[model samples]
Target chain A: MARIVGSIMSTHVPSIAGAMSRHAEGEPYWKPFFDGYEPVRAWLDEVRPDVAVVVHNDHGLNFFLDKMPTFAVGCAPQYLHADEGWGIPEVEPFPGDPQLSWHLVESLIGEEFDLTTCQEMLVDHAVTNPMQLCWPDPDDRAAIRIVPVTVNTVMFPYPSARRCYALGEAIGRAITSYDAEEDLKVVLMGTGGLSHQLEGRRAGFINKEFDLRFLESLTEEPAWATQYSGEDLVRLTGSQGVELLMWLTARAALLGGARKVTSNYHIPISNTAAGTVVLEPAA
Target chain B: MGTGTTRHEIPGTTIFDGAEAQKGYALNKMCFSFNDGTNRAAFLDDEEAYCHRYGLSDDQTKAIRDRDVLRLLELGGHPYYLAKFAGIFRLDVQDLGALQTGLSKEEFQARLVAAGR
Candidate 1:
């Protein structure tokens, strides 16, 4: 049986990738950011998760205005970089684990998750940016396979935070039921969030205090976190509140109580809080 | 290869037809906010400025000068501006990528087809 080794919730700001990709070990802009994740890196090295299930929202990529599913899963062998208006940056293609992904998909659907599966898809910064932060490597692309899950946050009438948390629980059930012989240590990652508005006149708003409180509530009282519907979240934190659905992943991982390994918060990464948290299952 | 005489042929009809254009426009309008007065004004002003600056063909200039919503939508991909147009046209939210609640694609498609596409 497969078991979730840990979970992570990180902000998906594109600039974080830009910072890490360009700076050295102790450079001014990059030092604090990389240093913050040292403990997380050590934890991951110890746990050695076999697979990572990343929950992220596509930013006008793949599912454009044509059709955006509430939740889509990638079962492809590889994922290309999604072009966001301006073409894709010079980045390595993401390798996917088709077998594991399909198994999880079949299991989830059997468990009644209603997931949409894709063979070929493009992933934008929402998925890759935080990934670079968590698993920073140039050549070790195939070290761990990924199951990419997308949420609908671009348009209105998005899923409620509670619904997202429920989805997480379903994922937990599916992972445990998979018929695999190998010892599978799964990592559920929720990427995007920590209050920052983007769009219209309120493009540059940043609430560090709100971000910290939200992070605290995520680990301590996840149920309280889900009370805010998508609409309420938007009203309180502008349109970007849609990213709160990423917390569902954390909620899912915390089904049996997660031991907090590391947490860090930084400000003003192109008008957003660059925050990250790593949690492992309690011993 | 040596140069050879070649006949240039243009098809009488194309995929970019009236219905497709209309569908594209509807999709864009449904998805964006182009119906707002400010956005409409900016669009009109921009069209005029583009026509004047580029010295484009009469047909091209007319496409912009006339404010043909369908033509404009066909030219530019569906964006936020289309939502405003959707509001103005009163497009059905279902037609604008709202997947049916608690239903699979096959189930939703069957219902849609039964209701007449």
Candidate 2:
């Protein structure tokens, strides 16, 4: 049986790449964001998940406005990171576990969630940043494999919050049922906002109140988080904050309940508030 | 591609939904090309020729000429792809914030700091 070891929710703000590449450790402006992921490294050490079901959104790298899917799961043998403009140095290709990726595609389809399955494509910052943050060292990254799940947060009319929740549930069911040798341990990771808009007059908007409330609701009353509409999401959190819905999928995967391990929230990571949470199943 | 849009009732935000994706396809394709440095230089060298090469509609051509974020949004330019176009002009997405809010860049930066407070 496949076992979901835990879930890690994070912010994939691209600038972190520059900060890390530039060795911004001692720099006060970038320290908090870098420091924020320290615990994730420890947690990854402790959990040692066999695979990560990384849920992230694209930034016009893979699917242009041309053919964006509501949800896409990559089943390729390897997914290379792309130069997201400004030429962020490409990292080594992320290893993929096709068996599990296919398992998810088959199971999710059986559960009535139509997801685009990609055999070939490169991932952008959203997926790579979290990996870089949690396991910053290259050798550490090679130890584990990934099943990249891309969500639609870039374009408008997001997958309803309820649907995101249900999708998580389906993902949970799928992972728990995959008959793998030696009981594969899994980690479900969700990336994107806490608050802070990237466009429009209301841009630069960071509702820390709403960000905290969102984190609280997601960690506690997850069902209630599902009740929010897209407008309400934007009204409460900001335009980009609607990306929090991606977190719902991971929250739903915690077979028991989100036994919050630890969480961090910080503001102004290039026009966004960054948040991270580590959740394990309650006894 | 935009057909699966969840339903956009968010006011003041023109979502790049399926209809918008279909409408702004050519414009976005042009912007997406900006991911390559040479392509960006090409656009900078001959903006009209670049737009024409991508089969940009007249409105999109005008929007590119004007560097109008709002007009591009009206033309179905998805925020992410549009950011690439804005990048060519050395304008970050935050620049769009200042542009939309009718504030200076520092003023916009202050507003972001203010909101967090």
Model 2 TM-score, all chains together: 0.93
lDDT of 2 at A43: 81
Candidate 1 residue-wise lDDT, B1-117, digit = tens = 212423222121112223433444433432233323454455446755534443444554564455443344345423233333333434322222222123343453344333221
Ten-residue region with minimum lDDT total, candidate 1 chain B: B7-16
Which candidate number maximizes lDDT? 2
What global local distance difference test value does model 2 have? 0.83
Question: Which pairs of residues collide in model 2?
Answer: A157-B6, B2-B18
Q: Pick the candidate with the highest TM-score.
A: 2
DockQ for each numbered candidate: 0.02, 0.54
lDDT of 2 at A180: 95
Candidate 2 regions with alpha-carbon error over 4 angstroms: B1-11
TM-score of 1: 0.70
Candidate 2 CAPRI classification by DockQ? medium
User: Chain B TM-score of model 2, please?
Assistant: 0.88
Give the alpha-carbon lDDT of every model: 0.62, 0.83
